[model samples]
Target: MLRSIASTTALALILSGHALAEETTHDDHESVTLYRVFVGDHADPKITAFDLDKPDNRWTFETKGQSKLYGVGEGAAVVAVQSDGDQVNFIDSGISLQSHGDHSDIDIEEPEALGETLTGPRPFHLIDHAGKVVINFDRGGYAEIVDAHDLSEGEVETVRMPQARAHHGYVAPIGTGWVTSVASDAPVEGDKAPERVGLQPVAADGTPTGEVETCTAIHGEAFSGAYLATGCKEGILTVKAGSNGPEFAMLEYPSDLPAGETTGTLIGSKSMQVFLGNYGAKGLVVVDPVDEPHFRYVELPFRRIDFALDPANARFGYVLTEDGTLHKLDVLKTEVTDSAKVTEPYSMDGDWNDPRPRLAMAGDEIAMSDPKAGLVRRIAKETLEETGTIEVGGMPYNIAVVGGSGMVHEGEGHDHSGHDHSAHAHSHGDPQIYKGYFEDSQIKDRPLADYAGDWQSVYPYLQDGTLDPVWEHKAEAGEMTAEEYKDYYTTGYRTDVERITIEGDTVTFYRDGKPLTAQYSYDGYEILTYEKGNRGVRFIFEKGEGDAEAPQFLQFADHGIFPAKASHYHLYWGDDRAKLLEELTNWPTYYPSSLKPDEIVSEMLAH
Candidate 1:
């Protein structure tokens, strides 16, 4: 059922540069933030990439068969597992973020397929952890461990496990070796493979190193912080990195709870040290391996359609039920904090492969694919409001998101050793605030004069015909069609504000020609670095005297790191400054009020 690839052929193909891309660099101190959504079609042998920052930009790659996509190498690349075709293909997501002690540098290129194609029989489960990808080939009765970094560079070198009896099992990397499933020596029956009995830790050379831990009917697996967990009918089997080797334990399901309940599929939190698993058809359980009363069960109203955990916001998990409701689960609180109707009713009574909605977290938003509707809806995580939608042709099924904020420093041959240490400091405890060291001399405290002027919103110009030329110019440059560009900007520039006027410490917001003024005082600033190697500085101001309805806090972002006159700017206001910073969508932008529509179009085209 599986076939091995020739390493020499793969190396030759990659060296020919047939599927490699050139890296992209940025000027010094320039920040770059990009997130890409990879969508696999329900039935087609294709995958589409949607760049979240550039709405009009799209890329589709042909595959041997339909695949289930997974982002690996910390968002640097993606692997497409084609079980039916017995193939595994690698994709350079064209986005790489390298971390320094204080900040990270990002390099972006065009997405391309790697020359290597890992062919194996009935490739099933995949686990990406500790800089490696472990792919389970069920029919082949083996697993291949590939270094993620090498795969991203178009190199193919896999450490294959010694072949055993063919069975539906899994293997995961742990403590320099691996923890693999163990099959019983029971007599075979019919055409079905032998069932897995337990798990045993093996040396890096595929030699067994420890006794098998009893875990019957083992199915799903996940990694939470330092521990790797797998589902078992008897209990939750856990493995941790030990000084000698991998240490294993079993946390049994509490007897006081339901009797016949067990978890199958598991999801782990990246920010918090916890795991969320599906307990039966209409229930979820939060498992804490190291704590007492390990399992906390949450009963759902209906059978689950799909569930995903927010990697950035570790405290939250999302579940979409067959009733068309998406419930937001607070993992720390072990309860559903909020619920919203996001899609049409997707009944559980259907084929397991039926087209349904899948959830993926993109930056601060949650992307849910509505396959029947041929759309991917973007929902704001905090408000759970539908912010926008992407019309992905055909049924968008399995989805994976990659990319984050990174810095693009200027000039060639710049030494990364020399980091800017001025205008920044380290802080912790507040999860809302940006953690880690920030080395930017340009980011500092400034007065309100940096934005003291009467400004107009660009949303109106985009609405009228004044901005059509800008779209046409973009279309001419082979981005998107003029109409498509217009549609894209319609979502980007959407705002209710018509104008904004600032004088001294007073800020006035005009909506429908009515002015609401408020007074504010300086409340310091925070520099936020994104996963894509880009960073932003938010000048915070707290309301001192203002109208009853005015927001309590205001943050100004005009692409200016320090004190300077702003040509145009985006403003965020709310009662919570930390919560306001999480608002990536619906930023009401402002330009000089004196500029005419023609002038505005010219300004836009120049950028």
Candidate 2:
């Protein structure tokens, strides 16, 4: 199978100090990828940052009030907006990745608070664009613009709105000035803010530059490609850079849609030029600004709890419904591709601020905060399967992810030629083959020694009723019936190849007794942790001079990651390495060619 590679996330562009050093080429370099999750508590005035690479390594910072976290400055820092406390705090994520033409450099450090806080009257909506951060003070009737680069360097400089009246509105940076929501000057009763009427482009000094564009009851906003879209009661308001300043346009809702439906929350795709917005309660609208009939709606079975777009895989979006099922939406196809039950039912009848689940993407995994359980569940973005959960003390409400992949180059003057560094060894001369039960680490490029053997696919055995005993044994030990177990493995083990033989760097795939030989070179390994807290490493290899019909990439996953002969393994091959990594289903499993059907069943039951 093949999949497309999309653009990198903003985190991949934020480089650390070490990455800015003078460039030098190295003979060897190591690939490093890291992700840090920042979570805000519902009841406590604190935020926590967990290093996904090292689960035990985490840092927490106290805030002035309960906060919502946002990753800003292209992932170099996170802003904690405490609307109830009327203050905002900043934290340096300390994880940075920089792209340098051919490769990227990564730097990791302890996350810490920036010791800078912005205080105002009811700071509500925040926007990050073009290296600038804008915080709108709904009650203050003004907005403050801060340079993200300056914020990262311990400098706090703000450009404030001039003579602006109070309103529960928003402001975003565009061109050399800003596009802000315009509130009606009519007097209001009680402590309520002014009524939002339209939007206007303002100069850098907060002076209006253009006439107001009527966008009634303006609410949510997001940027995708060259367009910035905002939700409006009438329809959607879009903004783009213009020669004069900023150009604004209104895209009214199609007549065929429901009469009162509108989107209040919006998310944009990083890899594609599109936007996904929550339409009413049980529907989502996918918008393409450049195309006619810009909106397409997807109805959910239940009210949506929260939804997120996959930045890495751009075409996929995830929605969590009140029924506790996570549906994977193929944005390109405008349909649900897969669904899985991930959490207990979270009713939508309580207060809007009641603890509920929120979604954030951590690399290839989706981090969802289960407030009632006080845990953050990590689910695979591709399979929608629960991989692991991190326990947080109080209810974790809001979360933001920061980090990317890069290269760690060796210092000059060092030569490790002809040395085998693929595997690590202990001081007692034993190879550190088994990582800790809960520990996961990046594995280096390994040689073919780990898989140099003859293997036979188990799919044939399962189809021939040879694995019936194994399924019955599992049913006796588990909750499922024997027939149910058989159906599950039948779906999992469906493959064509019946055998494989590996010698040196060459591999032979036997299909229908016809063999196709190929040569491969070591690439890298990716470690995936399962729901049971155990991890498996997929040793990847790239095809070299080999059969013309052979796949470009091959991944072998066994229980071992170090340099040791494998007894059995699962094989995956595809043209796209990134896409191949996301394949959780249809893994063709194999056993030692010397093992008999009875012996294989015995080994399976033993596990």
Candidate 3:
């Protein structure tokens, strides 16, 4: 699931109105509002999907499991734990979400239960790794694999983690290999060696590769960026798909920190490789584990009740306390920037099951589910104040914001042929392009168009890789042989140069992104040389076809494979630099202090 973050905030809507989307005579447009919030009522045994903006519109579906064990994918699909039996309930989380170019919608539908998956005993952890479901059982110490689309069928394959405990561990499927935190092959207790666990690799066929990357006292696990990290007493282990296979690198803590620090709890960011975690009862740590000068911490006012990273607002982390105040954390600055009292002081002194305040997001609003009050608190993300509340009968446990505003075509046409319509005039009774706001309405600190740093765009598209759409799917369905499918459409791969930011001597390659410390010097014109310990590559920023002098392409003369029989390979601004891209792509037409769409368009027209 692509981390689809909330883009359009409430402030922008109130200030600009629908003028942000200019009605154009382009094509068919649909008017839709899709912010749907799902709350799992533990006492009631139901999952409810309701409009975050308007709570009156909602749908609740009965659930089978009560432990609140669940997972929510980016596609707005929900899988709840069915602890009573060897099955996990699959619910069609009625959020019809769609994102294209720079626009997204939060469309909602009546939530329905699709089916259930045959899982193992005590399904503890759930993770949707590239559409496949991984369910971990606590007492059985086995990880079950089931088809995410059709949970009713499939012989549930399970692999056991032979740790000397009742399975308080975690598992993640990175590509075809499953990564799990297991006890270090010895008779070790789960709570003792907080870092004395090995991140063992389980192959796609449920066979352990026997490669155990060691991490002492590994407790909690999470996915931030492309790496699946396992928290330890000493530091954190960043596990990512490497050139060979899943690579594990240890990011150790500074020597000067407290003697008994352990990473027991962690919440990672989807936009970047960062984590916000509990250092102790009254302390929190912000870690960019692999980057230089990697660690930072902030002292909390009270013990953390719960914390979640605001991926939509990438710079901040949301933390709730027993004191009933929600604190906003700044990742880059490593400080608590904003605070708002969500509920009356609900101390974390009682039993863990005692009704406590929960923190979540309803689009751009911060939602705190107060089970004790039997109300879901909504706080304005812009003003950080309590906006309103929605009353529910039971204690809301599992919560997620999914679906988005998208187009639902009203008019109908039966023609279904996939043909080139470029020759025909699209102006005759063309579907009116409804005015809509861009999905980037939430990013306010920086201009949408104004991005600084050494950016790398690659060309010829990556030619070596996995995941083919047509032929592979046929092979998977047993409709064609594997050899036959490979002969038709060969597997394609993309290089590490998807997107990058280089400033000074440091560069973070954001695709198969890796941080590199290099020395860059100008060779000639826009041509430059990047040398990292003797290995060097030539980089040139050639002018794009637009306006002749406009820089829109980046090319690497060395270190990249060139297309066969091609003259040169260049990374154009987008997929292609052809005139067609200019028409299909809705780019930033103007850059100004105020991000009003109408004003920006007017300025561009005037120019």
Candidate 4:
């Protein structure tokens, strides 16, 4: 789901061995070797190679006829495929070239042709394991699995949901094969459009209706041991890996939370929790599947452009904010540890599907896809330093790098006189980070801190009810009348109304410790409301009008409604109260149309 990409390469190194000999004895800090990043341009259809130690320098590799690549998959090896097109290429990361030491020796194979010619549309995503590739074509609505090493023939899995329209989908290889989202169901016979878009509005308060569709297509997916978190519009469909197939469970958000929500992006953590992005709220939300099936809402500081969890380091992950800063977030502590500006501002205005840079982690390098810059930014995780770069021809959208010296060249290859390192200079950056050799015993316990852009810090505290704000009304629920109380607590409200006091035909509302006054009819019929920035709250009461003095009171939630006397009414007697009037006018637009006013109000108070 990450798209930002830029490529710039540099060469620099720190002298080692003599004075640093003392630090080498320390276990936590060990010098890195054989670090490289594979970045694909966003504008062009090319993949660039960069040495992590020296990111400023890189080499660009043109794909088969310069076809646009949509996604990159990395496991035992790295595979890049052209979406909505036919073709796939694979390279050997096991060998290192000269600049990358003798460890990197890339063996490139000829690009393989897809089975079907111009079938509906090309592939949208590439799922690769070992040397196998599964390309899902959105237009055809079928997945073709091919041998990446040799694509002469392969297997094809057809996802035929006669009632579904495909958008973005993925296939899981290790666990369950493929599970798609349900975007739209088919119409009857020759109907132009489908009867429904598979979305049924729940309580306007943002509660789950639990309505199941005949079919669904999830946009994105990630695997954690045995679970696959599928991002869907209705809710996350939790798929548990089973011997038969993945088990499906739908989780919805609680109704008491704020409205406007959708889980657009999903990433599973090692701790069994799922990180989800709410496109409606424009913030990152964390959901503990074990705690509650429904997701919990936690607001973020800014819009999240791209994010990823580090499987190696669970304590923290990096988030690239819209402002172009790489924010190192402590997921465990739920706080930002550090941030640095890394790119130019790319507004989220224009098209919703516009191309933008994204974040990715490859070994010790934090690879940033800068579409505008047409380059990839490589930074070291430990020092947060820009080690190198790769200048790609077009904008790079997504990247994945995997390949490192396994045993630190336990053999004596240095006995040679001349080794060609310049050929790799254009692809990798400085040779220093990957140049010097290290003893395996010297780095046995060294931290994998060198892995940048993809590293995460672990959450120290247990994720559960502790992080949620306590609901004070829960403990005192039994004290109220069971019948009348049914309408007392607003299970959910469009706005947070702390309290409302009512007396003989008059009412005065208090919001966050401030008194608000308004007008009504009847002998007293009083009303009061207040506006705080974007928040608007109102209180309706019927009691004898009086001043702030000994006004009759009616209890609601933690708030009290009192009589609104002449003095309070005069403050808002005319057009000066336009803000409150505007808010009330628009209240119904967000209120649940499915529920009655009394039911809606009661649920808000109780929630």
TM values, all candidates: 0.64, 0.64, 0.62, 0.50
Model 2 clash pairs? none
Q: Superposing all C-alpha atoms, what RMSD in Å does each candidate have to the true structure? A: 21.4, 22.0, 15.0, 26.8
For all candidates in order, the CA lDDT equals 0.74, 0.74, 0.51, 0.41
Candidate 1: residue 140 Cα off by (Å): 0.4
Off by over 4 Å in 4: 1-32, 54-59, 64-74, 84-86, 95-120, 128-133, 147-168, 173-217, 270-273, 276-281, 293-298, 352-355, 382-394, 412-607
**How do the candidates rank by lDDT, highest first?**
2, 1, 3, 4
For candidate 4, the TM-score is 0.50
Per-residue lDDT for 454-566 in model 2, tens only? 57778789888998997787777676789877876675566777877675456767787675666688888887654434455788999886677777888876545466446
Which candidate would rank higher by lDDT, 3 or 4? 3
After superposing candidate 1 on the true structure, give the runs of residues whose Cα lies further than 4 Å from its correct spot: 1-28, 410-607
- The TM-score that candidate 2 achieves is 0.64
* Model 4, residue 51: C-alpha shift (Å): 2.5
Better candidate by lDDT, 1 or 3: 1
Better of 2 and 4 by lDDT: 2
* Order of quality (TM-score): 2, 1, 3, 4
Tens digit of lDDT per residue, candidate 4, span 1-607? 1100111221121111010111111111112244556776655656776555555445566664233332222322345566533555554433332111122222122222234332335556555432236566665544555543232222232332221354445444422123433345544455232232332212212232334332243455554434556556566666553323334666765675556566766676643345644445346666555555355554556677778776657666777767777777666566667887888887777774466777766666687778887777777765567776666657677676654432222122321122212111111112221222322232211111111011110010102222112123332444444332322212111122223322212233343534343223332222222221111112322223333332232211111122211101001111222332222211111221112233223222322
